[model samples]
Target: MMKKLFSLSCLPLVLVLLSGFMGLQLAEARLHYNYHPKMLFVFGDSYVDTGNTRIDQPGSWKQPYGITFPGKPAGRFSNGRVLTDYIAKYLGLKSPLPYKFRKLIPQQLKYGMNFAYGGTGVFDTSSKNPNMTIQIDFLNQLIKENVYTTSDLYNSVAHVSVAGNDYNFYLSRNGSIEGFPSFIGSVVNQTAINLVRIQKLGVRKIVVGGLQPLGCLPGNTASSSFQKCNSTFNDLVLLHNNLLNQAVTKLNRQSKDNSTFVVVDLYDSFMSVLNHPSTNNIKEPFKPCCVGVGREYNCGSVENNVNKYTVCESPTSAFFWDLLHPSQAGWHAVYNKLQTTNAFQQIRY
Candidate 1:
């Protein structure tokens, strides 16, 4: 009877092991099933820009910027791949080719096109190029020209990264804080219009990103010795995010699938990683890894060959890359937080 009981126990163990194996197989199948989006169309500014800027453009065509990437300035604004590259990798696709270089790299045409430009916004920008509306118009013109088919759009994902250039433009023009809300209204209205245009163009899943914490960017925090975030600027970001949330809900109702639109919360993700610094290896959580010697200089280049900037010995140990962008490591950490949220995960399908 003791031996019989032992055999029965062993039988249950064998059944349990078999069930675990089957569960693993089912999960793998689900991952593959959900990873079906074949293309990625990008819009907005530098956060998602994969080298859409001109070779003469100071932002992309510089050394030290891509020094960590392909050992050269490969058009990304960081030491390596930016947020959009990782998002494409997560979706099982290659980084979409820059819309500017689509003619040069025709093979990348298959993955989809990137319409984002560094330093540009929904409205006219300090950068001398088409704005967000013009970027979308380019894609629409491509569709009219038959560069991409409806099937491609239906099976694709789109990323829009409007990381507060509109507000920057407002401030640059000396627009008062009292007028900020109206400016935000204009930004969100145009953004919503852009979302609808992409959906109408037949794209199935669109992810519009929330602005990262502007107050935490080294540009805004430098005055505080990088010790504190400017809460005033952050407040405006919150307002933008609230409006974006409403816009996404409205667009989903209008699209073919209830899943037509999503928001990638860069604000919370940046704050989460900053609030809870990675337990291992990062040396500076808030300070930029790469920065110039003075306010007038930038991360990638020097003025009159004076070598005006400095880069940390290890880029991965820092969060901000320069005054405005995140390091490759910084983006990786933020991506981790983003993946934890359901908003981004649902876009995988």
Candidate 2:
């Protein structure tokens, strides 16, 4: 019989009691449950990234990034943890170590590894970071070396997050708005290919994040005084999400037995939080907790100790931590809503 994990009701108390410690022991204890995964493989961009980007990259490795979590810069692209941290928590597992740090701590390998790099996408972006294909190649190489046995993979789940960096690159490169649908198709198709490759490499289940409402990001909402989302951008985002959903459904149908692909509806979950801020306890749905002092600067901008970015009085009340990413509170709310849906169940044994 499968042992039951810690109940959700105990989370608040556990956090409070373990405030002094790193608190991973509670997560490990919770994983004693039967259906829980033994490992979690992460790929793709900043949304699920936990310090995979290089130290030379100022975007993630600088100050104000991990201010809300580890209380210092920790290479996460948010004021605290991103979606990856929440997902790991949900699975009763410690957040996976980044691929860049895998060799430094061999003991952490049992929880799996993260190949996500901030500012990366399915294809190469302006950041010149490793693309999704290369990220998977890292895993493949490790598997080839017998770092993870077939059984380890059979008991694991893979999470993929490709959060709009490709579209940003496409638009910035003067790609026509009219060709957006075709571009989305290409992205989803390549994502499907990556998913299949992971399965073939031995992963049992894969969770792919659908695009969030791009219009609702602080970068888009700034012009509207953070009061409303740009409908045109949101419409384009909807097209991407719809296509992605179809692709995931097709992948599941083509799978040998049970559904192997799951789509986390980031669109709906983001829209829900933004549309019903009161329900989610978000005081400012579109306003970012961090912003630039001028158009030339952005979150975490600091030059010679002259700070160009300002942090909000309370990051916990704001939905966006920066122009593009969600605050820790924002991700927590979205994760709560996700638990109420069937998406997460697709990965369970």
Candidate 3:
């Protein structure tokens, strides 16, 4: 886990002063804010994980995971594309190859690599997978090997998704709710450090995802019969996003390129879609399209060769794919929401 480096109150005063001078401004020329990014580098958990967790993540490689996209199971946690693929689409590039599979397809190296593994967080989780720090170490190793020179990263953008794995891991360990705000502070503080490290390595820009409404996740909402969200948990998510936004803003000011660090407010984007499900043609915004037959099972769970999970008739009609991830269509809807946010404009031409 990322060390609880400092409190959220430490959000530098200098960033607040520079915010007006550096952030995207309508008065600035269009060309100044737009660039043709050649590649994408990804970090964090399943939300942005394309296919990096195959070995440790058996469930994702099982049937019904990639059925929505490749017509069969792949390493993607969703039935189809998740946040990574949609971000690639928005940038007009193919989803970056998985770091685990980079050796098999060296030709695709130009596009970039995904270091994210499912079930991982900025810190180590129960999965024992590489945390965000280790993920960056992989990139550092490649750079040292001269596989990716500074030029390769100069025209590239990075996407970091913090999809609440850390918090989930915390809860699973029986961490108290009263201590969550302190932990959230550490997550955002470490995230800022990660952004700075990536920028220093030559990535032109870094887009960090904010925490979504944890109260609305299927895992949390299952108790409410999918009828409503738990406001208490969601309020904590707001705290996370607030601190994350502050960190990103400060990171932008400290970057070599002004506004190099940007944030995609997943909280607002998710809440908007959930609040108006029909606007995105979602019939069940709170429930998942894929679910376990019993609490012990999950989306792709199997026992004695018999399927232990159920899939909805139409995934597109549902907002969630499993308890923790979104369906492909769900991600597309979220991506559309990003287009309308100022933070999204930094990475999109």
Candidate 4:
């Protein structure tokens, strides 16, 4: 009887070990995608921001923000790495250093820099920082100052993550819903200029993102009890994505390298993960695993100098970390979808 019991215990252990090994193998296989980039230079907003926000901003110097990362808040908006980190890892490169921090560590400039700032848009949003045009202008200045030589620009990869900060600003200022289409047009027009500007700045390859399902974000879904997505907002997101696709197509056509400008389809990826959570092993696809109790707080927010937000036991099971941002697991799922598509593939040189 004792011998039989020991055999059963050993069997379970063996199976568990085998399963873990198999999972590691699968992850390794996925990492083997035929893609590589010399350097990844990122711009735009919080989604791809690797700590470019000013110190005064709530996200840059907050707690619970980096609890899962380097054990302290390192300026990333999410619990851990964001979309850009995963994308850089996928391309076999380290997450590029933020432009703000780059000045402090000049050696990091060789790996490329992240010029993305949270809450800023192609045009100015609420953030009191450089807009997209000014962000590019900063890079232009860096080049003129010889911070990055022409060779670095020619061999580097550029990524822009202009989420809908402009939309949020419009909504906050009570911009009429009737003006939505025109606003979107202006956003895309400026985005196109930014893309062209980066290419002209000597960056060889570029990738821009289509907006995610803003309506399904934890913030938007909160009013609906997280049971239903706001389709109206999703419709607006689709319109924006459609315009972005057209712009990328046109930009590629006019570029000298004859290389395509890629669009990271965050919209489709978010929808896919939300609609098919089972496939991604996500238990809460819309509801944030971390949330504040009342309207006066948010993920990582503190009330009365205490942690107002409650964190789920397992962040990997949750799709959202906060109202506007995704959990690290959520970004992992989206990155998986992006890897399966040719968009990310085409950007690899």
Stretches of candidate 3 off by over 4 Å are 1-34, 55-58
RMSD of 4: 13.6
The sequence of per-residue lDDT tens digits that candidate 1 reaches over residues 298-339 is 776677766777889888778878888988888888888888
Q: Which regions of candidate 2 deviate over 4 angstroms?
A: 1-33
* lDDT string, candidate 2, 88-182, tens digits: 88888899999989899989999999999988888889455899999999999999899989999988999999899999888889766778888
| TM-score winner | 3
Candidate 1, number of clashes: 0
Instruction: Give the Cα error of residue 258 in candidate 1, in Å.
Output: 1.6
Candidates' TM-scores? Answer: 0.88, 0.89, 0.89, 0.87
Q: What TM-score should be assigned to candidate 3?
A: 0.89
User: Scored by CA lDDT, what does every candidate get?
Assistant: 0.86, 0.87, 0.86, 0.84
Once fitted onto the true fold, the runs of candidate 4 whose alpha carbons sit more than 4 angstroms away are: 1-35
Q: Write the per-residue lDDT of candidate 3 for residues 1-349, one digit (tens) a residue.
A: 2344453444566577568666546446566556678899999988888777764455678888998898787788888888888888888899899999889999999899999988888888845579999999999999999999888898899999898888888887876686888999998898888888988888888999989898999988999898899899999999998998888777767766677888889999999999998999989899999999988888888889999999999998889999988898888888889888888877865
Which pairs clash in the backbone of model 3? 1-123
Over all chains combined, what TM-score does candidate 2 have? Answer: 0.89
